[model samples]
Target chain A: MNRTWALYKKEVRSYFVSPLFYVVAAVFLSLCGFFFYSDLNFFLQFGFGMDIIGNFFQLLFADMSRAMLITVPLLTMRLFAEERKLGTIELLFTYPLREREVYAGKFCAAATVFLVMLGATLLYPIHLYTVQPYAFTVVAAGYCGLLLLGLMFIGVGLFVSSLTDSQVVAGVGSVGLLFLLWSASWNEASGSDRVMGVVKAFSTFEHFSNFSKGLIDSTDVLYFVFVVVFFTNLTLRSLESRRWRGRR
Target chain B: MIEVRNLRKQFGSTVAVNDVSFRVQTGEIIGLLGPNGSGKTTIMRILTGFFPPTAGTAWVGGLSVEADSIAVRRLIGYLPESVVLYPDIPVARYLRFCGEVKDLTGNKLRERIEAVIEAVGLGEVRHREIGKLSKGYRQRVGLAQALIAEPALLILDEPTVGLDPSQVIEIRNLIRNLRGQSTILLSTHILHEVSLACDRVIIIHRGDIIAEDTAEGLNRRVQGVFQTLVRVDGPLPEVVGALRSLPGVDEVIEDAVPSDAATRLRIVSREGEPVRKAIARAIVDRGWSLIEVSPIQLTLEDLFVRLVRQQPSGH
Candidate 1:
């Protein structure tokens, strides 16, 4: 645990010192700000009555999810890829660090950066609350769902990063993978009833929709949990394969 | 202390390290000398617990490297051939991170970082980013990180490969300062470094231990029959015949056939014994003015070439 924390601190320091992190943060915040203002405009123009705040929060969640699908890869593309490219992975492997600790430390560092970017979006909720009274339950659940979704994206990004040494490849691969997952719900339109149900159930978009509507289901939570664990373990195995494959 | 028994590593069909085995006592410094692609780095990687050998076992500090890797890693400090480091981190911060990874904390970590920074002369650039430092400083930082943990065994692979002449001397001096403190196993193809820094050298050719001895021992091993050059101001045939008939002289050849005012003859000895004195006496008795008579020094390069030729296939 202590070693993991040490690696975590080093990783976070590397991110803050790097100019790329600031670029990523600036771009993500600008996109969030643009989405928030548009969402506010839509809410003011069309939401005259009938739970305007809940609908407004739902729109913001949808925008945030879309923004994260593109930006989370930026945050995670360098996790393992840069280490290997810079020849520093040998340093990590020879150190007294378990493969899991290195993975967890890098994962938490990227997630922390992701959450900080998410934290910037918190001001949007405060703006909504100040305008008038809003449902705390809907907003809180919506943020919870966003956090879960972001965690899943981070896991996927980290796994893709482990697959290659070039950050370009990692970023592009993660984007392609996330797009495929997001588009899986389209399969529901062409399948039989039973097959459609399964497709919708497996689609991350379908699962995230429930959380956006203030509906908390264990199954929805389980879906994000499953995605996070599946990719996290895959990243771990990818690292362990370095030893098994006997390269570097 | 370290031990290996018949260690072998194969990358697919290519055998990297084959049937290689040697030991380092508690405080001995052993140099691993080999040409490029001769498996010096591969053996160091295996010893450092980065990967297990394909067919054998290695032990470091009395523990099996394959079985107790974490424990083995704790016992050894490694500086890879290329000096792998985080280029963006400041020198002190990088050392602190390595210290913490090595389980150092609080006062101990701080103390070691300060000592190593000063030890490697990195105090000037302790706050500088490693990438910005010159190659010499970067190499020093690599050494400092390896030393920060104060492990019992230190493994340095080509510690001075890319440095200029003076930087090489400084790095060699720093390594010399570390001589008695830890058991050191350094690998280099530069024969001068091995002769200057290492007490004993293990020469590997194509993944096999070709020769293991001290500098003088290696020279003697390759110089079983000696060659001496004698320059005399006399007739070429008289000088060659006089030198050949001398006791201990195996054969004498006219190196230069009556050029200018002198003739040069190369005399070969029958055994490892000295034949120079006998040749000089014969020249003097023959009334020739001998200009020079010196035994040729057998260098490490000569020994390496001979060994490589003698054992064509190291496997």
Candidate 2:
């Protein structure tokens, strides 16, 4: 565990020192800011009687969730791919570390970056708080939902990164996979409720929606947790498989 | 403290490391000499517990590589052929991270980072970003990381592959200075390097141990006969005939050119024969000035070629 954390800290410090992290953070924050302003203007023009904070929560969850599908890949693409390309994987394997330590360290580092980016989006809510002193529970729940959704995206990104030694391939492949999962619910509408139900069960967004509406369903929480654990386990197995292949 | 028995590794039908075996004792520097694709890196990987051998067992620091890899890893430090580092990281930070992975922390970790930096001559660049440093400095950083843990065994594969001549000498001197502190298993095809840095040399050819012994011992094993080159200011036939009639002289070959004031003759003799003195006496007997008489010793390159040729073709 100590070794794992040491690797985690090194990875995180590396991200901060490189330009890649800043580039991704800049692009993500700009997208979130644009959505916040556009959603606010649209609601004001429509003059809806619904709560403004509630409307912003909807926009934040929906658009930022899609934004994550784009940026999460950028964040996790270098996790294992860069190490393999630079031949540093051999050095890491030579250390007194298990495959689990490396996987957990990189996973936590990427997830922490995602969490920090999500935290930056809290300014939109603070703006709402200034306008109206409303209950904070729903907003908190919505942020929690975004966090869980981001974790799942990170997991998928890490798994994709492990499949190849090219960061471009890992990033593009992760985006494609996340897009397919996002659009999965549309496949079940044409007289296939049973198939649609299974698809929805696997769709990460479906589980996320319940929390965005201020509902923390146990099933939804378990679903996100399961996805995170499942993908991390797959990443670990992929690393172990490489040892059998013996190329390194 | 390392032992291997019948180690074999294959990817599909392509064998990378065949049935190979050797031993390394404590405080000994062993060089794994081989040409490209001779399974040098594959064997080192197995020793470092990076991969399990397909059909054999390797023990390092009294721990089996297959059974107690974690313990084995704790006992060994490996430097791969290419040095790869986090380009964005500072030198000190990177060394600290290596120390941490080696299970050092707090004051011990800090001390190791400082000591390794000084040991590798990286004190000037300790705070510099690794990406901006030159290749030589980067290699120093890699060496520092390997030594930060101070393990009992050090496995370096081509540590000076891409360095300039002076840089190579610098790294060689560093390894020489580390002779008594740790056991080293270095792999390289640079024959002169083995002669200079290693105490014992193991030559592997086509995935098998072709020769293993001290540098002089291996040279003597393949050096069954000796050849002497003599230059004399006398008639070529007289010099050649006189040397040939000597007791230990096996054969004598004289060059046709006598135009340069000195005639050249090569005399072959059985091993352990002192043919130089005999050639000098022959030249003096003929009242000719002997310009030079020297035994032509087989260099490491010649020894390597002879060893490889002695191996069966299927190997």
DockQ of each candidate relative to the true complex? 0.60, 0.71
TM-score of chain B of each: 0.80, 0.81
Query: TM-score of the candidate numbered 2?
Result: 0.89
Q: In candidate 2, which residue pairs get closer than 3 Å at backbone N, Cα or C atoms, i.e. clash?
A: none
The reply for model 2, stretches above 4 Å from the true place, is A52-54, B226-297
Q: Give the C-alpha miss distance for residue B66 in model 1, angstroms.
A: 1.3
**Predicted candidate 2 versus true structure: per-residue lDDT over B138-256, tens digit per residue:** 98898899899898999999999999888888899889989898999999988878988998999998888999998867867897677788888887777778878988888888754
lDDT of 1 by residue, B105-189 (tens): 9999999999999999998899999999999999999999889899899999999999999999999999999988999999999
Judged by DockQ cut-offs, the docking class of candidate 1 is: medium
Q: Give lDDT: candidate 2, residue A198.
A: 88
Give the per-residue lDDT digits (tens) of candidate 1, residues A84-184.
89888887888888888888899899889888888988987887788787778888888899999899999999999998999999999999998888778
Best by TM-score: 2
Candidate 1 has a DockQ of: 0.60
Where does candidate 1 chain A have its weakest 10-residue lDDT segment?
A: A48-57
Off by over 4 Å in 1: A190-195, B225-297, B312-315
- In model 1, pairs of residues that clash are none
